[model samples]
Target chain A: MEFEMKIDYYSGDPGEFIKVIEEKCTGCGQCAKFCTRDVWEADGKIYRPINLKDCVECGACWNICTADAIIFGDPKGGTGVRFTHG
Target chain B: MTEDNFFDVIVVGAGCAGPAAAKKTAELGLKTLLIEKSPEPGTKTISGTCINLAGMHNEDLYYILKGPIEREIHSMRTYHINDARTTVFNEIPTKGVLLLSIRRDIFDAWHTEQAKLAGAEVKLSTTVTDIIEENDYVCGVITDSGEEFRCKVLIDAAGVNSIVGRNAGLIPKRSGDNMILYVTVAVELGEEVINDRFSDEQGGYCIEYYLAPGIQYKTWPWIFPKKDTVTLGTGGYMTKDLFNDKITNVNQYMQNFLNLPIVKRKLEGGKIVSWGLHLEYDEKISQKVKNGLILTGEAGGFVIPFLGEGMSPAFATGIFAAKTAAEAIQKNNFSKESMSSMYEDMIEEDLFLQGFMHVGKINKESILKKSEEEISNMMQSVVLGGGFITNAVHTKWLEGAENGDIEKVQEALDFLEFIQPYRQIGSEFEEIYRKLRAEGGS
Candidate 1:
């Protein structure tokens, strides 16, 4: 199966769980570079979590964001990506 | 906040560490609360899916072994694939199980259940959005439900990207060398198929580790077998070089790993059942405590992902944090100096956690200093001297002797001396496990 198809998420909006601190983003695109899900997208001079629903809540974009622009927070309770036991 | 919202100890994130911490605190008669974001305690988390028994030798942690488990692992198969040939080392270290294969979902849920059974109040489907601080002390937390829960001591086991740790200004922006981003995929192959492919006559299963260029960047990729699912993960330290021409992303590396002849054959009929992305913080944080708050597990930087050993440290630190919290409550002092020092002392006193961490430090340092190709060549020769630790110590001591660097030799000797007692601890733990098993355990 495709990597995308194997994942699951609760049915609901997760709110703005990930956002780019516009002023802080250097646009080096490290967040986008590091993110495997392509959740971040370039927007003029900053990056936004354009595809938040695709996020697995891994926080890679947040961790590798050199400019400290990603405010990665948990989704609403019981409403985010759900992973089966590994 | 109402009096009902107050707890003696509140543990956030019911993962590996939270449940342990809460269980310990509640067992000590402290009013405890364990909170998790997911409706199901462990359904949202992903990991390598195996626990090292050698790490859980502590008498306090023996009960953890009674949780839901999948398989007993006694053997390991390491593949060192070079341009010339592939060297396979199938090591049956002992008759006793060295590790236990687990489903993080079931295992963590079981663990949290144990905590609940031990009298810790649990709140599922709650996310701690912010913490309530009083007089520079994190004495309470605010959940997503807009309800506030206060506690004398708060335990943070919220994992690598924990907002609690970040909001406290302890978790820094970590990338590059110290951060590892690994992707894992579990394939379903029926229980019979898995048993036929991955089990042996010794009533034990094997974990396969692959090492080669393109497969992973320095770190070893692992295949761990569950009851009916086989989990395979491969990735590297989140660095500039993580992606190259050959591997554009982690999935590409996963593709290459799945393409390997041996792995491909084993996974022939298997279909990918679940996939996950995980990040591990390899380095310890500068501080895990301040005032009324304490950090445990990945939030506290207690994970050594490259070594594939974390669950034990999580349990150890969790229990230690609980003990420290209980002691602080006893003394009526939640000062950083008192609680922090006590927490550090407890962790430092645990020979198993300390020794495991020391070996990881030595091995990681050794591996990073050498290239992948060089390490593969060495493993072909090095496994005979034991594993990475032995290879590193031997090489360092010999090189020191050759270069007349007495300090270097002395350093290696000191490490060896410190690690000596830990080396023979497997049998001791195995004996303890046998006794525990006979005394009635899962």
Candidate 2:
């Protein structure tokens, strides 16, 4: 059987991240709508990331949090690409 | 005596975007000149409220904004009228916070000073008559005062109705109809008192409310709390019918809604201050730089959809254009390739271009196919009103809720489709809801 590649990096799943405080959620869905990650779904009233590995730690969810439920940890240094031309 | 005219770059419009670009260029050791049509920056510029950070293309200038911001909004409350309910939202993307209402005039003055400190020469009250062209390349800009400033690159941050962009032949004479947005009124109010009275979740700050609705057209009122004063205004989609007296003149249309019980309650002894119009344009993205000319800010049609807020994008564009111009001078190359790198930089930022495209698609479709009422219904149903349903259904009881009816599912899916394009940045919307429910904020 082909092996599934594991992303060893410590990127938190926005889905599980939101689930930590799922019951307290009023389901305004603002987080889901504004998230650059496509992490939350309003229809299901749930937060699940399609791929937790892709999060760049932009901290958008943390800023948008009125409830302050989302948490973020530091990523490994020199892990991402910086657009010098940008 | 004629000055040496040693400027390497001349930027028009000292608004937030213009001055920011000038400051960046100056900081990079480029001889920069910033020009403004008004007595100062943001004097003539008009926008409803503070800028959003999701569209920020330059991170350096984003940090600079921290010093001038009036307040940061971590959450928003959207009222659903038909349902007579309100949905409170906590999650806003981390890109940046909603502006603490600020006086564009004051903020712009500070920005101009920053640019000056960075070594840019700023000439206020200077209006552009035309752009000087050598062959197809824009060489300099001519002011109405019979003066000409020569530079290798001409950056246009001239606000939404940009005469420089049109004159430079960078943008077309006629552009497509995204939405006919016409805003009138710039009423000023006492900031502290207004914020104390009106601001709810984010201090005395900016608040937007829906007054009336339709699919393609809608109108809303805003109370933006600034440093010394507040900007209270209203606007809607521009169509022939909105101006017709049979329905309502623009002024009456606004007054009728503002006088409502809920809205009027907030303005119980308030005064009607100054008023102005914000004529907006929605255009397809094109190469903002051609030859030696570049376009920045709203003049480049960088405003956001759903809310039409663009100050941050404008500022970001300014920074990009100035840096690009500086790079060209450093390399001694001002070709289309050299100058257009800034435009490429902005486009490459997924948020900037993707946001632009998302709003573009929604607006084009809304104006072309949907009626004003339909657009309103969609906004009310999916965004404003729907938010309430989402929050309430998840937290409390829906009274007569059913599991999974195909028809209900289809209707819900259709509603989601209506708001798919305008959904916020990373889809953190649902996360906010989940967190709220888990925390039991009832």
Candidate 3:
């Protein structure tokens, strides 16, 4: 079976739950390097959680970012990824 | 915080620990409140999907056995794959259930409902965005809606990436050695297909563990069957080497796992249903409590993810935390010293928790120390003579002898002796389970 990285999400806006502290990012790209969901994207000098809507809230990018650039917080309640068969 | 929002005890994150903590606290006559970020409990959670039976031996936990069980598992299979050949060790079926399979979404929802029935007011889809700490004492919490709920003591069952624990300064951003990041996918195989493929004869399903080089790093990949889907997962420690040239990301590991010939055949007509991602803290946190606050479950780091153990320990520790909260409330002392003594003292005495923790530590350490070829050879020895337990002890003993470390050998001996009774606990637990089922609540 080819899952093709398909995941389900709730049908509402989660708001700007994750953001990049541009000054502290340092362009290391560790967040993008380890992110399984492709939530982070490289934007010249910093990595941004561009696809924050698709985030499963696993905290890998935040946990791996050595520079503490990824300002991670919760999306609005009940408005993020909705996992099935977990 | 308003008077209406004040509660005797407040529990956050309605996952495995939160509901148990809330239910027990409410049953103890404390006005308890449960806050969950997800619209539904467990819908945002993920795991290898087996609840170890050792946890249910406590009468306080037997009610869990009566929950919505997908399958009662009695046997385990470990696939030791390498370049040479595949060595599959199938444990002989036991008379009693060794574990139970479950769907987290269903189980957690039911558990939360139980907490509600026990008089705990639950708030679904509410995130605890900020913790209210007054002079180093956790007095209350602020939700996403900016609603503040005050409490005498707060139980943080908010999981590994807990906002409450992180804001409280107890859980530091950790990676590499102590943290584990894993990815899992569920395949829709239908209940008949799962039973047919996994061999659920005699009302017992089986769980599989895979140990291969490209599939995992310092951890075991697993396959567990639910009612209409099979859960397959693989990943490893968050080390610098985890994202190497061979395995660029966790998905590659999952792909490699699926590509394994044995795995490929088993999942042959299955359709991918859902995918999951999660992080787990392996080591126990140093500071699990502050004045007026307590951390249980993953927040306290009482989880061994590879063993499918987080839920059980979560339940165990959550109950203990509730008990500690009751004790602290009775004495009107919300200091860390008081809570820690009441909580950690019980944790220290839990033989099952301590034993599994030791086994998980030594097993992961010893397995990771060797090359894949060496592991296949070692596991072959496990089959030829003594079983899995003896093999672990035997490997440690050999290492100790090679290094001329008598203390290591002595420690190995002590571990063997310590784990001796646990090996035969199935029959004893069957008796206990039958007794408990007959009496009540099961």
Candidate 4:
């Protein structure tokens, strides 16, 4: 059975906030596992930030990556997810 | 810019710790700059949406922002998934502890305002790209906009990412075992629904915790009631093996948590207002300060190991860092020797020593020694008595005295006596000690 994935609840474009250095990525897939958003996807090899727009810039991917392959910064002003009731 | 762009203190990340440090440093007459990568404080930050504000009651920041506190959590309910048993721990006034459920966005915004009023220059949307070093001492930071701002002392309150501290080589990298990967969802259900469903009266909001052993190892799920929403979350150690077996993805874990009968029933019609992923490190405080740099809050590994509470520690360490930085600035000594002593002494006196008492180290061997019921009872007791160490002392002291094991009684008594002055469980411990002594068997 094929089903469509639900849209992420968070709004705004993450806009280049998370950068994955492919050379350093070991295809360990830890980033994809740690991230709640489907931002990173593993394709049998290296993990890529396939859904950067859905990224909330939580920095969990960068922190869990042992190879230091990910660089995460906050999105530009007024461009990332804004919580109304945090 | 050149050296003229320097301040006495530069605090990176305007989360819980940064603003507090900036406020204190500026109040002490030091030129201070507080920078935030987000457009506003708390916009990108993730908490369980419930903060225990017991310790911050007397602070000016808490006093100013106390209006936003949604409810005072008077009791907590724990559900043992394996046995389907529940235990409740009610708050005792004499214990001097109660959790205040708060909205972090409102709280962080209020804190930032307080810092600005105290004369700290708060720059929003300013990302610190890297630490600027001079002669092996971190003297300043370079922002993403290619602007360099030098300072006599740099404080990193940048949270679990610990960007400035990590880049400066002051904070060590943490492994997956030491990291906790968690997700939270804020479900909106209006005030009446919340009050009706959670039975919210004055000081009567309940924070429920679920221990699902079959689903995940060393993991727990929580349902915390807020003013108009309920926060559902779960956390587990970030190990590859654990991830491979159960939590292949955090979203899958969240889905599983929601599927639980209790959670589904309570949140049947509630809409998810917001969701987020946050990482917490459980490492003890180590190498937090060096020549011209200091690490505070989660960046300094201040989150409590067992319960995953960081806000209180973040606030406490932020204030301590500010005081320490002020002292160093007043003495005009940014050297490693002077600043390290000032920072270390405050941390040791206020945070580190007390933290050591409640390490809450859990292992497979310890779990194996107890029956499932015993483990459940111990978990309830630990949550009720503040932490594992206090609960252990209380249990051992009572059991040993009852069994007339002289050596065990003596050891438990001695440990209780040592930790009494520092711990808040003093009155409770004293009552037990007096009863045991009056029995006079041992």
**What TM-scores do the predictions have?**
0.96, 0.66, 0.95, 0.83
Error of 2 at A70 (Å): 55
Quote the true-contact fraction of every model: 0.64, 0.00, 0.68, 0.39
Candidate 1 ranges beyond 4 A from true positions? A1-5, B201-203, B426-428, B438-442
TM-score attained by chain A of model 3: 0.91
Q: For model 2, how does the per-residue alpha-carbon lDDT over B341-431 read when each residue is reduced to its tens digit?
A: 6567655554554545454444444434556555445545545444422422322122224554555455444444544554544536334
> Each model's DockQ?
0.66, 0.01, 0.75, 0.38
* Candidate 3, residue B195: lDDT: 82
Q: lDDT tens digits, residues B276-348, model 1?
A: 9889889989989988999999999998876788888999899999999999999999988999999999888
Runs of candidate 3 exceeding 4 Å displacement = B200-203, B379-392, B395-400, B417-424, B432-442
Candidate 2 residue-wise lDDT, A19-85, digit = tens: 3266655556545543433545554664543444554333334334456445432222222211110
CAPRI quality band, candidate 4: acceptable
Each model's lDDT: 0.86, 0.55, 0.85, 0.70
Kindly list the per-residue Cα lDDT of model 3 for residues A1-86, writing each as its tens digit.
Answer: 56566688877788898889999989998888878888898899888888887788899888888898877788889888888898
**How good is the docking of model 3, as DockQ?**
0.75
Each candidate structure's count of clashing pairs: 0, 55, 0, 0
What lDDT is obtained when candidate 3 is compared to the true structure? 0.85
Stretch of 10 with least lDDT, candidate 1 chain A? A1-10
Q: How would the docking of model 3 be graded?
A: medium
For model 4, the stretches where C-alpha displacement exceeds 4 angstroms are A1-15, A42-45, A73-78, B2-4, B57-67, B83-97, B200-203, B213-216, B244-246, B351-377, B381-387, B392-415, B422-442
lDDT of 4 by residue, B1-442 (tens): 7655889999988778888889888898989999887776877676836665433433433433333567656566666665454444444344322466777777678778778999999888777778888898889988767889999899899988767877877666565667777777788888888887775334466777776553334555778888888877765667665465555776666777777677678887788877766777876756788888989988888776455477777777888888888888878887778877877776666532354424444322243356545666667667767665666566666767899888867776776666655555335533443344355411
Question: How many angstroms is residue B368 displaced in model 3 relative to the true structure, after the best TM-score fit?
Answer: 2.9
